[model samples]
Target: MTELSAKYGPVFSFKCGQFDVVVINQWKFIKEALANEHLLGRPKETTIPGVIEHASLIEMSGESWKQQRRVALTVLRDVGLGKSEMEDSIRDQIKSFTEVIKSSEGKPITVADKLFLSVSNNISKLVFGQTSAYDDPASLLMAKMMPEAGKMKFFNVQQFMPIIANLVIKLNLFNMTEIISHIRKFESHILDEVNIHKTKNTDDNSIKDYIDGFLHEISKRQNEKDSTFHVNTLQRNAALFYFAGSDTITTTLQWMMFYLVKYPEYQNKIREEIKQTIGLNRQPENVDRKQMPFTMAFIYETLRHSSLVPLNILRRATEDTKVGDFSIPKDSLVTFNFWSVHRDPNLWDNPELFKPERFLNEDKSKAIKPPYLIPFSGGRRVCPGESFAYLQLFLYLVSFLQQFEISAEPGKDIHLESVQNFVTRKKELPNLIFKSVD
Candidate 1:
């Protein structure tokens, strides 16, 4: 994609089946497009159970989209999204997380499973008003299938040939059966939770969590023709919250460990920063982030390095829009290639190098976040969970480093290549030996 973008220039359009896709390689073009309300609608997503018209918040657009997003953000904040309540919840998970590592007894251990459970449990609290047990069958299945689900990207052949794409989708020839089944089962689990919330029927004025809050909205707007606050929408959006919030953060924590093991110096540097700022006896808090600039820099660098979701959630033109010199027709699929923007040579010196220092200003007292360093795409449609994700990463990374020293397994290579999926992730996840720092 980088090479092709270089050849065709920053703004280029291509056809996938009957769908027109415009890829924006440069940050400037991406910024312009994201800021335009006319280009904010998400492109059609085919993997979930429902019709594309009833898209989840991540894929929904226009007034309905606006309502869903506003409701979600408001409810999340009301329930301690960026507050101390959220931090306390994460600290509890971190307690269990460290126990899992301690059980390894200083041997090499795979951390993804524990990380998934911890993160999923956090999301579960927000959406279901309760956490899924670590050993719960539904939770385990959902976590196990998420990485595989990421592989179910839009059918490449469908882009250029709409008829064939439709035929293939009809025939299930693209082999979406397994993927769809997993998603259905997961959505069903969420539905079960929503139904439970309905039965409880908590006071309309006092909502328990997102499910209860959504039910209140549903009942309040039952007469509206185009209401997006119904049960099915709740189920789908809950699944989206689980899938998007959990998997991305899980992959990121994995990448953090990978970089810490691969580059021991940065690990030590981050540890020293944590120790100096919060000390080893106490866990780090989100508030401490301001005092630990290097720790924050390391996390930012990891996001830039990994570029998970390389091609961000696809958007479509709600109306004809002009990005740069190119005219994007209404309903055209548009994507901001974050991988290209993050690695653009013009943006960073020696763009390929893993230098957290680049994020630090000359004085090294603060982190300079360039506009191009958009691990999370910007504008109104920016990741709603940005602050929550940042808190999780900050606390988890600091807690992990404070508790143990992680290193690559003896006699094994640490390959940095990533798997090509909906979210580009490390192809090889190393089980590093964890030695207690104390």
Candidate 2:
């Protein structure tokens, strides 16, 4: 960090290929970046091409971001995040995923695709109060929507280079207008959900999904003229759930199975513990996790090895700031070096090695440590879906591992080089064989 800081300076600028860019590292510097008024300041509908737009999501910088973040936090709590009710929804998705595996009849399944589908379905249900039973049209539509959505580049070229942007726009190079159309289609689906939730008398019944919680808040704050509360906000949030929920959990699951395949000895160790603790014929639950420490350790190792956001998303600096003699100017784009943190050699013994024991103990006295575990990133912008993510990952992993014996197919490997797009996704879908032990 010191080396990079010296070269970049606190507020110095650098060029990327043809575009100028700003980099920030210090925690305080980054926080200042996210508070910049002009950074996310455009009217929600007049947003730059290809980004998710929520009307009330205008760039407020300081107090606005803080207030909005608090509202989001409260909404998560009110909607039962980190509670048993959310766990039940997760378990239901796990059951759905298990059924998909069961129908495979000992064939290799696409681990990435199946997990993505399942995780997306689970979160969609929570966010929209609409459920998808795996291959439903809604699920299929979203699966199709995501990849294309990722390919659209609105903020990159335009935000980075305003001069070339005018040229790009004139030549009809990248269609900002089309991305909005795609967003319109996406919002259409969310509105369908919002309309259904309203018709269902779910408010009175307190159905307790994200949409329910958001709408309730909207009603509470309706009379407040300055509030950003609205039905469209609910729609955008519903769509955002699909964005936030699906990919990270899917990536983590892929790495989990990848390590298990590469290290059968560790796999056997986890299985042995699972058997000794709960045995077969019993459904896996969150409570079972505490008894299987080694199993949890393997999960952590996978997260370490699979640095999901290699470059991570950019945060804009709000003010001219100093970080150890460097001055990062206000409104400058900031890249959190989460990737560098994860792969820091000073933090790990042999950082490149696939060692689950690094998070557990080969010797009980000198316990293994997690050097840099930023799978979900951290701070104000840290993922809001983490509780649901852990629940989905836990239920699916426990249920699948306990019920099946997964093995790497002959000459095939589950590689971890998934290209990072809007959200990082597998370069190719992961295919793994499942042999039922049930």
Candidate 3:
């Protein structure tokens, strides 16, 4: 797409089976298109076989999308999404995560698995009101399942040719059987959690977690016509929260570690900033970010370089829409090529290079994140967990660097190339040695 964008201009459309898929390569067009109300729809559930039968927050359109997004934001805030309480929760998880690293005792160990579980536990605390033990069966299963799930192309032939895709699903071909089976198992797990939440005495005043808040909403709206709150939506949305909140953050953290080891100078620079701003005696706090510009810049640089969600969740045109001069017909699939934007030479100097200084100001006293960097994306359909993701990334990176020096394992080659999936990009990370800074 990035190569094609140069020849065809930033906004280009191509036919994919029965649909005209539009790709916006530049941030200007992406911003305009995403902010437009007519382009906010998601592909129909029938077109995506393995997705929840009923659309979750990511797939819902129009009023249902608005309602679910509103409720989700509210519930997230209620559960301390941006509050100090949430920071405390993440810090607690960070402590556990650091212990796992510390116990490695300078041995070469792959941290992705532990990182996945630690990140999952953080989300588990918000959605379930409790953290899962690293050895917990359910947590381990989910940590194992998430990466596989991320690799699946939920919008493949299914989006372009629904008839053939449906036939393939019915015949259990192309691994559709296993895909659907895994999705069903995931749904069943969420349903079990929902059922457990139902047993609790939930009310508006007694809301403790996402489940509590959602259950209360269901009860309040049971009598309303066309109500969107129900067991199916709650189950799917809960799963969405866990998946969205965990996988991407874990991948980003993995990239952070990879980069830190790859560029030890920057890692040492970040540690120095942590030492100066946060000190060695205490854990890094959210407020300290303002004073630690280089550290924040490094985090932003990793996000831009990784382009984790390269082509963000595909959006559909609910009505005929004009993205700049291009006319998008209703039902057309519109996606922004974030990879192109992040790597666009016009917007970034030496776009291919990984330099945290690009995000710093003249005196290096402040970090300047340009409007073009849309790692979490933008507009109404933007990631709901953006704030939460940032908090976790900042806390995890700062805390991890403060206590340990990360480097590649002995006699091992470090591979920084990303394995591009249909949705998110992942690193085939090498095992690294972590020596305690103390």
Report every candidate's CA lDDT: 0.82, 0.64, 0.84
In candidate 2, what are the lDDT values of residues 312-359, reduced to their tens digit? 455555556555466655655556555555556667778788877777
Those runs of model 1 whose alpha carbons end farther than 4 Å from true positions after fitting are: 44-53, 154-172, 202-205
Runs of candidate 3 exceeding 4 Å displacement:
202-205
* Model number with the top lDDT: 3
54-146: candidate 1 lDDT, tens digit per residue: 467876778888999999988877777777887898899998989888889679888887789889888888888888668989989987887
Could you tell which candidate, 2 or 3, scores higher by lDDT? 3
lDDT string for model 3 (1-438, tens) is 778888998888898877888888888889898789998898875336544467788888889889999988888788877888878878888898899889997899988778888898888878888887889877787777776766666347766776577687888766777777777887888888888788766333588899889989998999999998998889888888888888889988988888888889998999899888878759877888899999999999999998898887788999998988988889888888999989988899998999999999999999998988998889888887787888888999989888999888787766777767655454565778999998
Cα lDDT of model 1 overall? 0.82
Per-model RMSD to reference: 1.9, 4.3, 1.8
Best by TM-score: 3
Measured on C-alpha atoms, candidate 3 has an lDDT of 0.84
Which pairs clash in the backbone of model 1? 16-159, 16-160, 17-159, 17-160, 17-161
Please list the residue runs of candidate 2 whose C-alpha ends up more than 4 Å from where it truly belongs after superposition. Answer: 1-20, 24-60, 150-155, 158-181, 201-207, 362-371
Q: Which pairs clash (backbone N, Cα, C closer than 3 Å) in model 3?
A: none
